[model samples]
Target chain A: MERCGLYLGCNIPLKAPDIEQSMRKVFPALGIEIVDLDGFSCCPAWGTAPSFDIDTWLVVAGRNIAIAEMKGVDLMTGCNSCFGVLSEAKHMIEEHPEKKAMVQEKLAKINKTYEGKTKVYHIAHILYKEIGLEKIRKSMKYKLDGFKIAIQPGCHILWPTKVMEVTEKNPFYPTMLKELCEALGAEAPYYSRLEYCCGMGALRSTDQEKSFLLVKEKLLSMKEEIDPDMIVTTCSSCYLQLDGAQKILKERGEIDFTIPVLYYTQLLALCMGFDAKEVASISEIPREEIIEKIQSEERAQ
Target chain B: MQVETVNLTQKDRKAVLAQMIEKGGGNLTKCIQCGACASVCPVAITGLPLYCKRLFRFLQTGHLEEILDDASSWACVACNRCTEICPRGVDPFHVVFAFRRIQAQELAIPASATTSLMNFYTTGHAVYGDASELRQKVGLDPVPPSTLKYPEALKELQTLLDESPMAELGLF
Candidate 1:
């Protein structure tokens, strides 16, 4: 079994425990060992720390990376912001020795040192790369049974591709997230707005009305095209944005749809014969209906 | 569209753009103003002028004030779609960040952004509260293994920030 440090950034560990539960429940079944990463700090988040102070961003990110290095393993996270900011810091430190020195000085206070060699992995990419299609398919109990899923890979997983360890070769038209769903026996159809932002993070925080406008466009587009039974995404941010904002839009009468959302791991866990109550228990958005849909194998083509 | 004039002689040209470029704006002049960044911007699609293409063009021409009040900059989700689509390697997402930081430095940041930053400062996280009730429902250790669970780690994070500009800025 391959082993790696599980880096649970702020969002999943606190606000969305479901994602963390899903990761813990799913990885072991697939032969991936998740180390505790004891004493790990936050990824510092992009909008909050990284946006305001670059120096503070690197030191905090470096400290997290240093934990995995201490354990002699690579790092993996369910958060796109964590992956983006940490990976960006890793890139900056690698490219500039002076920046590395500054980070090293701060790390010295905490009695840790980051060699900057530990590669950061988003859960989706590593699962696709390390586990392979055959293993993922073999581990499934229900095989998704031809369920149609709308995919949102989130934004960070794609951009600043220079620093990202795993990125789509053709980011404009990505098939990685789609292909993973397909391997699990689901039909992930492509829509025109597949590349659009979900207006989470800074947008949603700054102006709800303006942010809703962007989510409204995506909801309307997805409702018109494909009309999939459910939504699945890799990053926690997209999961929160698309899942939460869709409900917000519906309440405001901005859209007339109710497609359920789940992390790819939660979906995989259900397919792997794990109890629905265990795998998807901590979800904030209503998922019981999606559970029934997955079991029934009825979807609009 | 009547283009408004930004008189170059009246402003110190390089001061604003230099800071932007330093903060990962990339080379603003490299932007071709092809509207590619605007085309992919989610906020732009909603009829807002939050176009990276225009932001760069304005920066290229020393018109920082032109795009300052536009709602798109605040509405930027930092999704990096514009940066991904850029042909000239100009990362508009970074430009948006530079603008947000400028706003943050001026203490014009929205309350929600400030709240998240404050949480990050105090708990070493953006979202922190007594979620032990929910965590127990998920069979978790109530607090997980982050700074909230370990006070010393939180202190270490505070120490790092105390030495950085975040302390003096008071945005967090």
Candidate 2:
């Protein structure tokens, strides 16, 4: 795709604008034009429309897809939930004529129709497939050769593979994010608990204490094995959860050490020469140490 | 071992089953009480007692009330790992979601989730956390071309939610 529409789901706009800002810089620098998808709404989020009403879920998510379909460009998003919900709805409406008619009737109330011609692309897939890692490596103004990066591709990015536009080689053991990190000259080694959820979303909202169980385990696993300098996630929710939880875990004396957590685009933008504050700032956990590490790499280079 | 006298006929288990099946939980009865979904469940692994097979059993025996007040069902993150792995193609995730839709009606949901849904209903975003100033710091448009920036579009979304059964139930 020469140019794809950018679908900024709620979180990236409200809680994590840095991800949006980072993508704006990174995508353009990589020579892929990102069109602004005006008048788009929420993916309606999994917790919202999806849980209560199926029609609301389909119509709201379909409307978001309709925006891009009208533009005649595949919609792309950095948020995994958006990728999952929107893509899954697109899959259902396209497969089931009844569902498509149902959703179309709802859309027609608002004077719209879903053609289902537009594909949904997650940033990880877009970066891996459309924008090749080789191109990213060559475009890099900085390298993470010495850095040990722990990648969180997030749960939605992998599961319900039917709706996903790009399929991973092995969903059980996904290497897409790790490969993307390695392409940036970083070490993204395999860990046993890599495929596990970050314990964010509905789980965290209902039971915060229990939610930390997964984060703690994953962190300890990473600490025991990779001892990564930073944790990078492709999902905004994972980015928020991991980054926020680590600091609180450290503060409550439940864990030791602080690892700077960033959305993948934040790191990519930094390597492509975007300012650290613009892309990687607004972090709940401090970026001082990681920024120092990246600066040192630049100096060494 | 205590001998448990199981009587599913006393309670309206069939009625519950009918509702579930109507809402795409038809495969729920198709559950052979397989423990695979439970074993692979991300929440169950975290000690939440949210097993897919067990959940179906609860509904089978009209035990949803036991789990209603608790946060057990609400904690489901909907990763669908079980759906992808289920040998019966039960799509345990859909079954779980069907129950959640019911729970959303009868039980009090988590405040954060409710707040998010309300925000989505009004503003077309699950989050209203201020990042416009942050966007300004990063030299981008403050509101990012969403319903937050467009009132007309938000009206369209609000109309969808207003007509939803959740609205008729007055959840918001």
Candidate 3:
């Protein structure tokens, strides 16, 4: 089995451990061994370290990459922000010796050195590219036959393709997530606002009303066009925002319908016959119906 | 909304853009005002006036101080659509971040950001929420295999941050 260092940036491990549980359940079943990157810190998140100082950002990110380097494995994360920021840091450290020196100097204090060897990948990329859809389909215990899913690929995984390790051939139209869902027999249909931001990170934190406007519009487009069974996202922040926004919109009476949201791993866990309560149940919106539907199929080995 | 007139002769305006370019926004000089970045920017789609296109225009014209306290840059999610679609390769996202850095240097950051910064130093998680119960419910270790579970590692992270320029900010 191929091995990778599982780098759980802040959210999935803390606020949304169910997503972590899903990842734990899904990867092992897919024949990928999860090597925990012990002592990993946050990807240092853009708003915090990055906004303050780029050097600080690179050092913190380098320290995380350094842990994986000691393990001699590539780092894989479910967080698009972690995947993006760490990937960018790796790129910057690789391209600029001065920046690498700065990072190395700070890292020497911690007794760690990052030679910029580790590659960062989002879980979607690993599932799509490294694992291959054919192996994924074979490993699934249940298929999402006829179930329609609206995908939110999340922005960080797609853009500034120059820095990102995993990118869609046409980022304007991302199909990696869609095709991965199809491996489970689900029809991952395209909606008009598929590429629209979910207004998660800094947008949601800065102005809720303005952020909600973007999510509201995206939700409306999803509701009107495809009307899928659920929404699946690649980013934890997007997963939280898209899932939580539905409840906020319902309470505000802005949107009449609700679409349950899941990080792609949670969806994959359910397809792999893991208990939904463990891997998929923690959410603002109830996913019982979707869970029941997927489990309704005959169990496969 | 009242229209505030910009003083074009203000010498600090060019310095403001220069600092931004120096702070990871090297492509700030490449913007052509074509609005291609704006076309796909989340800030624009959400109807923010100081979106990339306008922000670039404002910077190009040396109107930095006027927009210093605007808080529009804080609203960026860093989607990088502006970086992808910009015809001139301006990398509008980096410019936006550089502007944010400028705001941060001036202590014009939002209070929430201050809180997150403090949290990052203390706990290494910017958006930390106690999920011990959740992790228990999910049949995993309550403390994840991160800085939280390792005090020495957390100290290592703290030392790295402490030695960096952020320590100069005194937020930690």
Candidate 4:
């Protein structure tokens, strides 16, 4: 069995553990053993340490990455921000010796050292690249044959490809997530604003109204273009924004429609026949209707 | 809407540019104000005036103090779209982050940002909540296998943070 450290960043384990539940159910079933990366800290998320200083961000990220190194396995996370920070930290270490020395100086006090040994991966990237679409297709108990999913690969996974270990041929026109959805037997299509930010991180933290304007625009574009049955994304932050923002938009009369949002792993867990209550039940926007739709459609088939 | 004009000579453009490059925006000197970054920037698309392109121009011209308190830098999502599309390899995301570091040093941060930062220092999680109930509801351990479950590791992280440059801010 292939093994990797599971670095559950802040959001997945705290605010949105359903995404955690989904990954817990999905990966083991798909043949990857998730080794718990105990004592790992934040990705230091973009808004926090990264906002303060670059070396500080690198040190925090280095500590988390060092934990995975101690476990002797590559690190994997369901959050794009974690993936971004960890990947960028590793990139900085490999690209700059001085930065590595700075981080090492701090890490040594905690009995840790990031020798640039551990590789970090996004869950979606692992599923698409390593798990292979054929393995995914064969593992499903219920295929999304009749559903349309709007794919949000999230910004961290796509951009500054030079710093990333696994990336698309053309990130601006990424098709990996769509193809991953297709492998699950769903129709994941293109939209004009597909590459746009979901306005979740620092933007949302700075001003909710301005942030919603971006979400509202993305939602409008998704609604008009793909009219997807749900929005599937790789990042937990995107999952939170796309899922949680709809109700607020509706209440504010900014958008009349609501679309279900799922982290790709959650949808995969559902397709793998995990119970809905355990893996897919938690969301701000109700997913009961879509869950029923998936099951009812599966029964009819 | 009032348009604020800058007297470039009054601003310390050289100091701002040097600080930006020293912090993390080494590519700041490479930006050509081509607006390619703004063409896809969420900060610009969402109508914030000081998106990457304009911020780069401001920093290049030593207008740092004028925009230090501006919330526009805080609004950057770190999407890196500007970094990807930049023709001159400006890496606009780092430039924005560099500017954010400057703001942070000046204690110009928003309350919510500080809250999350303090949360990160204490709990090893930036955006934390009591998810014990949620975790159990989803059929998992009440506490995740993280720093939350290991006090010693949390202390170790706190120690590291205490020794890093972040400690200078005294936010924790």
Please provide, for model 2 over A94-195, each residue's C-alpha lDDT reduced to its tens digit, 9 standing for 90 to 100.
Answer: 888998998889998998778788888998888999999899998887788888999888888898887788988778899999999999889998887898
- Candidate 2 - CAPRI tier? medium
In model 3, the runs with Cα more than 4 Å from the true position are A297-301, B1-13
lDDT of residue A54 for candidate 2: 81
DockQ for each model: 0.59, 0.73, 0.77, 0.77
- Per-candidate TM-scores read 0.92, 0.95, 0.96, 0.96
Candidate 3 at residue A255, lDDT?
A: 95
Per-residue accuracy of model 3 over B1-172 as CA lDDT, tens digit each: 9999965564555676678777888687888788898888888888877988898778877787788898889999888888788878787888899888888988899988999998888988887888899899989998999989999998988888777777887888
lDDT of 1 at A189: 86
- What would the per-residue lDDT of candidate 2 be over residues B30-100, giving only the tens digit for each residue? 78787888877877888877567778888887776777666677788888888778888888888988888
Superposed by TM-score, candidate 1 places the C-alpha of residue B3 at a distance from the truth, in angstroms, of 21
Pull out the clashing pairs in model 2: none
Higher-scoring candidate on TM-score, 1 or 4: 4
Q: DockQ (C-alpha) of model 4?
A: 0.77
Worst 10 residues of 3 chain A by lDDT: A292-301
Q: List the residue pairs that clash in candidate 3.
A: none
Model 3 error, position A34 (Å): 0.5
Better of 1 and 4 by DockQ: 4
lDDT for A15 (candidate 3): 84
Write down the worst ten-residue block by lDDT for model 1 chain A: A292-301
The TM-score between candidate 2 and the true structure equals 0.95
